[model samples]
Target: MVKQQQGAGHSAEASALGFYYQAFFALLTLMRQDTDNAAVGIEQLDDVDLKVDGHNLLYQLKHSTSDAPPVISLKSKALWKTVKVWVDILPDLTLSETTLHLVTVAKLGLDSPLIALTNLEAERTELVEAMVEEAQRVLDARAAASKMGKALPHADRVDGCSAFLSLTDTERLNLMRRTVIQPGSAAVGAIEDNVAGHLKLLPPEQRPAVAMRLVEWWDRQIIYSLCGKRERVIARGELQHQISAIVSDIEHDKLVPDFEIASPPRDYQPDGMLARQIQLVDGKTSDFSKAIREEWKAREQRSKWLNGSPAMAVTINDYDLVLEEHWSDRHSQMVEECAELDQKGKCQSGLEIMRWTHENAPSTVRPIAQGWGAAYYIRGSYQVLAIDLKVGWHSDYAKLLGDAE
Candidate 1:
């Protein structure tokens, strides 16, 4: 019993890997073909492994973990199970338009009965007759076991074989005619190679980076669809747009900003020098919260940028210097305008300076890269400087924070 449980656990893990392969295979299909209206769905429409709407194709993906997987022959359970699924849904499909596909990593033997299904020119009448004979043999064996008061271990396979026998001769021939077997399909690790192959138009050195970005984005999109966060159908146009965006970023030397909509933790409280500087000028609670959120996003994005090429590090340093200069100029202007004002009036003027900086500073500063327009990155960078005492909002921030001039 313990051994059986371990085997079941291993099977479940392999099944999960199979689902991932299915998603990758779908992505590969989208990349290889040019069909504007085609959309792909996972685990929908009679619970087929994959359903490509617009193309009228349903796919069953069988993945194995072994380096030397067994052959998919006439009596292979995976083949019959896939056939059984299609047979059950045959009533709802248009025989002339719909195609059923069984995609597996297992190799097909020279004498495999399903070989005829792979070839459009092959005569399928003989194949249909042979399937009927095999189905009868399976049913007879189950009958023999029942007469001996014993249960067959694979009752599901027996049921699937029986289901095939119930179809009429015309239905059987039409079903066999539309079925396709794609043996030796790409495994989990090799799917990456297949994806890169479809990107031959790209420069050889850029293919890997582009493939990685596309695959990562595809995985996230699949997860979102599965989790009900978005529509389940993945349109080909959506994938193409993402590819274009990624390529554009790489070519233009731009950083794609992440965490743009991210928020601080619910229990987070504004603290430290940045918050103190805001408070010194009578900044409101909303101002403090926005400042903290923007600072967090900028710091996170900057850290990620620094992890890249040395050129990116230099870009960030230069951008920070630009922000500091902007703050310095603004601070000097605020001091001059409020020179004759009393303490309360000076504080009011300082608040106005902060408001203007937040509203207009992003537009004045030079972006780190061409076509990159994440204003939060600019706003957050200024807050980051204030946190480190390199810049601040109020005119007397240095003295208020007890910093050396």
Candidate 2:
């Protein structure tokens, strides 16, 4: 039982690794495409594949973990299954323009009949004939086995071979001419290196980091498209634009404000330290809600920055100190001007301070990153400070909260 469970666990791990390989290969394909308008889709039109520049380019990716590469023989299930998919969809494709690719980490032996398919100069008619002959042989063997009352497994492979032989000579020739067998393709790790190589616009030290970020973004985009959360295709131009933006941010030493649309949980309540600080200024329920959201965004962005790099962490700390000093100066001035006023008047002054902080503080205090102009970041950072009791909107907030020390 334990052995069985261990085998299952190993199988599951290999399956997941294969999926990651497919996704990374898709990223490599998108990076290598010549046309900017070409779009890529995963598990859509093909496995780890899609259309490029109005021409269908379907790919079947096969990943292997063996020390010695597997051979893709004529009767290989991977080869036949790939052919089956193309045959089933042949009617919907423009045979003249559509290209089918069987990309695998496996190797094709020198004497394998499928090796001819990889040669563009190979005679299409001869290749088609060879494939048809192989398909017929498989069917004939299956028939002989059935006559002996013996059942052969892999019905899917048999069905695929039969379907290939059922096509007309001309159709088979066309499909053979369009098909390409790319065996011994790069493994998962090599493919990642290839992806990083394409990021020549980025510095050598930054290429891996940028490539990782690009692939992560691509994975999310693929998931969103697959889940119907967005369009089903990701254009090459979109990918190029993303790369350019990431490079620009790195070059300019600017941080990307990635949490603009981030929010707190749906059931989030305004009852924290930040909320109480707002309430001390007689803030409304709406103000409390907005403050909570701003604080959440700020904290999330800060966490991301801290995880990004030591430089980013230092930048955040410096920015926070600047904010604290700015708020202290403003708070001192507000307290002096409203010191002679009644308690009700002081409350009104506190409300005015809160309004100014929200409306004008961002403009006065520049963002830590030069290119980032998101005003909400500044407002949210103030809320974060308020939450930590470092800053507050009310003139006597420290005394009111019993934290004057």
lDDT (Cα, tens digit) per residue for candidate 2, span 218-326: 7778768778999887888899998887777777767777777567889866437776787777888877777778777888888877777756777888899998988
Model 1 ranges with Cα > 4 A deviation: 1-16, 34-39, 46-55, 223-238, 259-310, 320-367, 373-405
Clashing pairs in 2: none
> For each candidate, what is the lDDT?
0.76, 0.77
* Model 2 score (lDDT): 0.77
Q: Model 1 lDDT vs. the true structure?
A: 0.76
Candidate 1, poorest ten consecutive residues by summed lDDT: 1-10
Question: Model 1, 146-214: lDDT tens per residue?
Answer: 899998645656767878999999988888898888888878888887787788778987777788778
